[model samples]
Target: MMTALLLFWPALAALLVLLVKGQGAKRVAFIAALVEFAIALFAATTFVVAKTAPQFELSVPWVERAGISFSIGMDGISLLMVLLTTFLVPLIVLSSFKHDYKKPNAFYALILFMQTGLIGVFVAQDAFLFYFFWEVALIPVYFISAIWGGARRVAVTFKFFVYTIFGSFFMLAAFIYLYFQTPATGIAPHSSDINAFYQLALDTNTQSWIFWFLFLAFAIKMPVFPFHTWQPDTYTEAPAQATMLLSGIMLKMGIYGVLRWLLPVVPSGASQWLDVVLVLSIIGIIYASVIAIRQRDLKRLIAYSSIAHVGLISAGIFSLTEQGLQGGVIQMLSHGINVVGLFFIIDIIFSRTKTREILSLGGITQTTPALSICFMILMLGSVALPLTNGFVGEFLLLSGVFQYNYVFGAVAGITIILGAVYMLRMFQGVMFGTRSPETEVFADLTFNEKAVLIPLVIMVFWIGLFPSTFLDISEPAVFNLLNIIQKR
Candidate 1:
């Protein structure tokens, strides 16, 4: 099954790299990421060939008395997330080769460690295991930003750490409370199996509070609405490679949590307060989109844009229709790819021009047409232009919302046009106008840069042109999920 391979490869990758000497470390890191990618691909192939129900299943007791086992399984959703994680880590590692960091070994090692934690989160079938992996995933980021970030690294990183941890504490308490309520298993208080968690029945009043506690953790992770204060600073101060990891793959953890944890665990509560969640999500979408229009820094603009998109995704989840949830899942994958591509473009621009301030640059397209073209495609993908990956996901999401409530769908619909405005504004400010002294000396993309981006560009068209390839894979799983929630 390569299930064990999936769990250990990154850790093994990190260990081997640490044994290597200076200058060899980057190569080791890159090779490690590549190997992990291969293993993940092998795992995916195995899943398909076996036609396994909970594909690639592995379960072993980690804490037997507590009914806590190291159980890991992947349906289509987890499989897709693992694919995104594997795909991006290698690119992020490759991107770092050209950049400078103070402690290269530790930096790369942490990246590998972060990969382990991320893969762990998706495959974890237990609640405690999920939270444990979740925290593990953030540790590398905290250190990466604190030790390797820009001028305000400490303050920015600290804020990021504290905000996330604060939210996490509430979740921890909620999980423990739920555990105690689980009929008092003989060997332990209760179990942490996430599937078992779905069976938990609680009053609406209790479910409402519990949902917020758990949802707060994810919302902060997604950085929805008022909880988003930590994102811009953290994104701006961190290195672009780190930012890629944060936005590209890490943010999906929140959406995954919403689908896998929140909706299933508290269906009644989710139904009862869905209107409030819908309002908040729509407001965040519009609010962040407006804020994006004002952003002078390209990274910050993307940061706000990510917030807006996630809010839209969150709204789709609250819609509670099969179509809405399906769209939400599809959007998660598409947005992950689009965001990764955008961050890579931003990193390339920074490398060439030594600036991320959108206002400080102009006429980049004149010298770097390839980079310009790539950026334009990513922008189109971001804005959900027709026949782009973004279009399929947003269309389904909007269709889902429209089916649920026209007023909600109509309000969220503004995001399509608003997104275009901000994305185009950012694109024009950076790529399109007359040449300026700052941009005059910029170089075009290298062979490696194009190599990293081409696959992503192909995916943009592949998904946009034929979304069913991905959508069909998600359908049965989403149906199974909705069926579970509806029955509950």
Candidate 2:
């Protein structure tokens, strides 16, 4: 079925890539990603928004005695996320075309394999399949960073791997517990279906414990607040392309997991702990923004800024309002686009100037107007300038947070100004100050670079100006989720 192919094609492509020799690996990977994107388009275009349940569903028995099933499908929200995944992946691949990583075949193949896991996470209807894909996505990223990353690659990647694995323990436990509790409607006495998970009735106290277990994993993956110590170092040390994957898409897995898996199954537990999550999220916003203001390394600064941005996104989701959930999805997509552009801009700079220290380089604008202009546009998007993608998402998010609690909403809203201060300050410091020998010869954007950036810029305006287009696609699914949560 098309749904199965859409979920698994990237793994197939990764396999095909291993057979290619030399530069052919990049082409095969690029073309494979392109084809995967095209199929994702087909799935999205075919998805009937009117349908409340999953579309293109393909279910089969797996481990029949244990009642596990291999099931996959897409609802409106999952479909939209599928579109984001498929859409960005090809770009992620193309963005790397200019770099000739050693053993290009393995590097590109791992990307494809990761794509397989990402799509699986989004489309999977069975709890076991979802966890399977979740862990599958982690492996390739570990190897990618450890092999191709900076001088501290081994230590940094090892720590990242261990921390993430530790988080997964909680998730695995939650899923197994859910699996045992599921009452079967089919051949098996129990089922691992997500819908069944949503329908469970349990003691409020039990739900609370289950919620924290699942949340620990999601929180650590998003690396929220105190759980976030590992992120900046990993971001700074990983290769630019791998960093893009981590920031642009991988982080979304945590947010998506919370929205889909956590809240639906334990609405009361979510309600019980909602205040705690919000406080941590808001604290992270101020904490990360303040740190971003002081960071000197371009990678580390943006890394901290990401912590700040996603903090607000997390708060919005936990608000548990219709607008809040909708806003979370919008921010997830917008953040994916904007953050990738920001990192790519950094990559372009480092490629040209050989330094990521914001202090070491200056007046890049004096020489590279095109690069500077793109940098400014992405900067504004990050700071959530009106009429940009970030603006639409943040506005909706703030509105949702306000509906939940005005004081926390107002406190969280500080990111608007704080984000701008840090972002523009970083921009002005790097692109507008007196030129140094390091920056005086800075070159303009290359064709390949432009190919990657122009689309991101287009999306910033398109989604900002007409978010309704994107919102409508996911509205049905999101509202359904909120309705379920409120009813519970």
Candidate 3:
């Protein structure tokens, strides 16, 4: 029941929002998102952290002849991902309050609609069901970016659409092939349940091919190095709210796919390609960091920085250490919080000065002390300051990677230094020095802006001060996943 509500509410709200006129749509959408978040929080209260199997499960035959089921549930991992989605969504919607985009109703409706697909992806327990929601999630964002984004929205969004859809085909192919491999049973002679996939025992050669097919899909979404060509342009070109949805919640879909589907479903294959994937992730971290340092556009720099951050999370997950996986899990939450805050700050800056170019702005702190403080905190979190949220996850991730290989771990550690270099440099350039003409009369954050950032700032400290609150929820599940891999 809870699982179903989490999956359907946003969709229903989206429909309701479509009926609303003018600015009312934003309010309705924001309220709907809040209600959804409350439901998720209430559901969290009923969750059993110690239980490894999915709870609040609901499985129904959706395609009886083909062996598909409309199955959904929450485990520690699915729950965390859902929580992240629900928590960030309202903020994403609320952050849009200041913007008066054309066709306001459709804009808000698409965001709420995207929420449904995102929650569905997080909670889905069936392979085909996961794929269904995975694609469902992409459709709204496609329209959001293409319709409401910057000047190059069409070209940039088309490329993003192509990259994702192209990857989806490979994933579908992989899922279909795996579906056929399942043992005959019931009316369909085979099942698409995730557990069925988990029990598959393909030969090394088969697993190797499956690894690439699946990796290509997940890697492109995570926008892992070499496959990440489409990300910077898309993130920069998308509207602020659209960018938040993509970076904060949508990208996690890829990482979640890797954890839930890729690693466990194809452990031997994952093991086979482990080193190769790690190298690529590490390369992304360094490559993105170097690029970010040279970027003059605040939004673009943060976009590249996101690539670096997720690169570490990807490497940590593939490293297969307890700390690595746990770090990856916690870091997903932290990164989502910090990145959204950073991007929102960027939005605020852009809205005020009509510029995001770092060199074209300066001395914002002189006039906007509150904005400076909030920006600094989010920036510090991004740079992994010791007492901030980013530190906890990076520490555990580095520890996990070190456990896998000291050399790789050492190389990955450079992210901390490089991260600080770029983030601090960005902060210094944007908030200090002589006031640029655009920023000469910069105003402080407005009420709505502070409303959006304060909660994010609070979370940065909460996660930093006591990560165990989240780590405990995911620990059992992480261990369970590792056990599956080890057994394979």
Candidate 4:
């Protein structure tokens, strides 16, 4: 029952958002998100990582004939992922209070609706339910970007929608194929149970098809390198809140898909294509990093940096090693926290200065010391400075990749240097350069803005200083997954 609420409560809150008038929608939605986060924390205390199979599992027969169940559960991985979703949603809602967008009810409602889909994706144990929520999560972002986005929102959002839908088509087709291939029992004609699907013994040839079909969807969503063309434009045009959803949490969907669905379900194919995928991921790291260095548009720079960061995460996951998987898990939380902070800072800057061009503004630090300090902390985390949040994950991830192959690890590790170069450079341009006329009178962070940023700053060092706290929660799940891959 509690597990079900984690999924449905946000949905209920979204409905409430629709009915509530004016600013009440934001308050009610924010409270709902807070309550939801509290429930997730409770579940965390209750979850037992030693038991590898899902806990807090709630399964109800949904399509009896097809052997589908309304099954949702949490293991260590599911728990952490769901926790990340709930933890960030309230913050996302809180971050947006400053903007009184048109029809505020609809805007807040869409955010809560998106929260529902995100939470649903993490807990779902049945493939059909997972797929349903995957698309469910996509719908709100489309509307959020399309309706509330900047000038080219319509066009950029259209392209974004088309690309993702194209990927989802392949994903759906792959699932349909898997549904038929799913082993059936006297209890049902076919099974869409995720665990049952894992028991199938398919030839490497067939696994190859499944790998690519699934990869097409996951890759596009991660917007991995070549598939990532839609991202910068989308991020640039979309409102900061929507971009926060996209980078901060939504993109994790693809990484989660790769870890949960692609790797275990088809180990043979994963091993076979591991080299190819790793190469592509490595290329994306350098490719995106190079582009980020050249970008003058602050939003575009972060967008590209996001791609590079995810590229490294992708390489770690495909490494299929213990360190890689664990690092990926650790990085997921860190990336979400840091990226949200960065985007929020950018949003504040744009709101104040009316420009996102790094070259257009200077000496922000002179006036907005608090904001500058916050930016410095987040930027350091982004660049993975020692004893910072980014370092722990990147260190573990690189180590994992190194164990997989020295050459691959070495090339992928380039981001450590490149990320610092560009990030510090961007910081220098925006915060510390000579105070220009435009930035001379900049205001420091307001109370609401501090409320949004303080938590992020705390998290940066919390994870940086005591990463083991986060890692301990995810380690068991990561090992459980590696065990599945190895035993297969």
Structural RMSD, model 2: 1.0
**On residues 69-123, what C-alpha lDDT tens digit does candidate 1 reach at each position?**
7888888778878888998898888877777677688889889999999998888
Better of 1 and 2 by lDDT: 2
Model 2 poorest 10 in a row by lDDT? 184-193
Better by lDDT, candidate 3 or 2: 3
Question: Which number leads on TM-score?
Answer: 3
Task: Give lDDT for model 4.
Answer: 0.91
* lDDT value, residue 127 of candidate 1: 88
All candidates in order of lDDT, best leading: 3, 4, 2, 1
Residue pairs with backbone overlap in model 3: none
TM-score of each: 0.97, 0.98, 0.99, 0.99
Instruction: Give the clashing pairs for model 1.
Output: none
Model 4 Cα displacement at 402 (Å)?
0.8
Q: Name the regions of candidate 4 deviating beyond 4 angstroms.
A: none
Cα lDDT of model 2 by residue, 402-480, tens digit? 9999999999999999999989889988998899878888879888888888888898998999999889988998988
Candidate 3 to truth, TM: 0.99
Q: Report every candidate's CA lDDT.
A: 0.86, 0.90, 0.94, 0.91
